[model samples]
Target: MSATAKKGAAKKDGANQPFIYRHYDQEKLRDALRKMYLIRQFEEGAEESYMRGLIHGTMHLSIGQEASAVGICLGLTDEDQITSTHRGHGHCIAKGADVSRMFAEFFGKITGYCRGRGGSMHIADVSTGNLGANGIVGGGLPIAVGAALTAKKMKTGNVVVCFFGDGANNEGAFHEALNMAAIWKLPVIFVCENNGYGMSTSVARATAVPNIADRASAYAMPGVIVDGNVVSDVAEAMHEATERARNGEGPTLIECKTYRYRGHSKSDRNRYRTKEEIEEWMTERDPIEAFESQLMEFGVIDQKGIEDIRESVRKEIEAGIEFAKESPMPEVANLEKYVYTEQA
Candidate 1:
């Protein structure tokens, strides 16, 4: 597909309800908000099915971090690139991956993305400009760094955004990649979605610094900490950082403070955190609700418009499930077809 196939229309208002946008336009705000809502509904649908045994492999849902993905994606162009972590459905969608094919993969259908070979963690989709989602904790950072290096070397005026969790900050690869990108002044954005935990271990136990962005100082770059729960803040920071990269600047580390409403995976028993913590995050900091309220207040989009958008997303998800269910599975004879880089 062409780079502009799924290209987003430029937005200028950056405003939404309850509060107006200081930097972003209303259209961009609406687009990001809409994408975030689609992500929420899509993940919730996956959760409902995963628990019912329709999904075979482990599924990681980023229910509370919609703002991080959408906000960041809003700042990027189709020519720019992104690399995502294990829990990456939101990234894929925000970057314009096919929702139907994603659900088909989740359902293990032959028509699925990856042709039913790769499951949740390995969904790569180039047409939409989403490189792929990494199963390893820090695998994507280096790949993004390499992509950035190439962009800088080729003078494409494009940037690469690397999305990972706070847990990945501890990985040696993460630090190494940042160091390289810093020195090279690569057009990259290292976005750390710090939801207070690395798998089950809280961020407090994982790091000494109060904020992950503070580490950017060590690399001689700007480190920004934004309220990940608020879409406005995330969009503002990402837009500026993106422009910074395009203007021949180094990378930026954006630490988005958010939360995950679900457990680490479908198998998790939900015992790592207190009930109060979970409930507080969901009730007070839910990104979708927060942004929806904002949009409503700003009168950018009415409640009915938002509801209609959500309903459309929900129906699309259901159609994907149906398409996956009716589709065929991978043939036994072709089991090794996609396992290796080369074909027979």
Candidate 2:
């Protein structure tokens, strides 16, 4: 039977289906697939450029954690704000950032975000409600809380999503921020992308709690866990958390159990984890491949559609690189322009 026919049959048989299959239509699901591809390809292109010395400075790549980023932001609107981590290209893309501008920023061109002053880790688009990516561990936590408080005071009804790594859970800021948000009933969702390791240290060694989500109970929030490799699962958790926040029920802490193919950053030698483990995650649990299979199985997309998306992303990446190469750099005379406030 065809995929749709199978879906119909399953429905008639009362078989439980993924939340996305019931909630999203074909177009949205396909678009989610496309965004996941875009994030992957964009990071690949960035890594290539960084290796070639076309881009300066080091970067943290969230290569294998695409689904967690895309899924968490899937239910968020343009008005919804997010605070990202150093490894945040995926989060930026999932929240609707332009690849060309991101590439330009990496290239240190004037047309880029922050006018090239802020590179990969600092890219921000207020227009899309991406407050910005933070370099410090757990730095964005308090900032997200502040934004949520503003949204509450303004009655904007917009929720703020805070994306942090497993390492940040131990930071004092994490505890303080969560406690404050919960006490105020702020519209914020604390999303912990637990990829098993905090740099070289295993999460098991660092955290006392077995799962990062368990930490949420200390703050009096609903703690939830989901398979981060599954986009639909992430989306379902985010959707519920978002609704609760909008209803003035306070924040939710969601832990996404995922993996990253690359090291923590360009400087990481990856001595802590074994090659076999990385290979297993990459080959068996690749988020994009798994999501694509889900799409095909649910009749959302076929091989040709997937190919088309890949090709389009390829062209866009190429164009972005070219644009960065040809774009102008910042003027030497304007060094202090954006740094200090001007007198009226």
Candidate 3:
């Protein structure tokens, strides 16, 4: 069936709302759904592992922000690069990192991407164009800019997508990187995942401006806002920004106004926000639920399809955990191998 016709079939209350991929191909929509499901399931499994004392250190889960990661990465090519924040599993997975390796990293195994030393917040897969996830709030900004600058200087067509939280918007690195990128017309896209709270403090109380995107003007670049909950919306924005960068027009700042369904990290008590607010985001504004409904409405998938995807994701996560369990721990002999380098 045509994608739009599929949407018509997924109606509720005798009305048909917009589907993200109504007019697009079904494979693309299906792939997106599968990726989102994988991210959600992986994070859920990671949480379980953490609770079970299998993973050391706390993790910042991106449980509700799958759409932003998948959407933005959809606009990037294999040659393109990305930098992620501490809550970055979704980004790594969406950028084509192996789930087994990621799980091994969390388990601190020698087979992991960072040889098990970086742990949860510092996963890096250079093969997939992921520089690394930064533990510091805004640490990845300048690195992304440097990557873009190198690409620009070398005349490479690749661009860099830098993902940061709203909290990073207030950092000096953000301003410095943006200014340099704009002036040099660097191939970079600054994506701000504004998930409301920056470690218990709400954005309203933290920032002077209403929207972080507005600050892009000071750098002489186009600033756009997208519904971070809608994968298609984010994809469109990223596509525009990426195109602008590839065309030598300069960097673009995209503010994705999203929400986190979980606490900021394992230690977050969630005291600053009420349960009602989280419930609203989880039940009503859930990106996965909304996308599933739209897919059903468009006849792209049914209950069976959704269940199948969930089951497959579950199995994949289970296999990853098993692999992690079987992987060997990092030996003491190589403990300082990657920690420091000899000066040239």
Per residue, candidate 2 scores C-alpha lDDT tens digits across 1-344 of: 13224334544543567778888888888889889999999999999999999999989999999999999998888999999999899999999989899999999999887788999999888788899999999999999999999999999999999999999999999999999999999999999999999899999999999999999999999999888888888899999999999999999999999999999889998999999999999998899998898788777899999999999999999999999999999998998888788989
Q: Estimate the lDDT of model 3.
A: 0.89
- What is the lDDT, from 0 to 100, of the residue 129 in candidate 3? 96
lDDT of each: 0.83, 0.91, 0.89
Error of 2 at 65 (Å): 0.5
Off by over 4 Å in 1: 1-25, 340-344
* Model 2 spans with C-alpha error above 4 angstroms: 1-15
Residue 236 Cα positional deviation in candidate 3, in Å, after optimal superposition: 0.6
The TM-score-based order of candidates, best leading, equals 2, 3, 1
Candidate maximizing lDDT: 2
Give the lDDT of residue 342 in candidate 3. 62
| TM-score for each predicted model, relative to the true structure | 0.91, 0.95, 0.92
Top candidate, metric TM-score: 2
Which ten residues in a row are the worst by lDDT in model 1? 1-10
Residue 256, candidate 1: Cα error in Å is 0.3
| Residue pairs with clashing backbones, model 2 | none
lDDT tens digits, residue span 1-344, model 3: 13224333545434533434543588878888999999998899999999999998999999999989998987577789999999899999989888889999999999999989898899888898999999999999999999999999999999999999999999999999999999999999999999998999899999999899999999999999877887877887888898899999999999988899999999998899999999998997788987888778668899999999989888999999999999999999987887688667
Considering lDDT, which of the candidate structures 1 and 2 is the better prediction for this target?
2
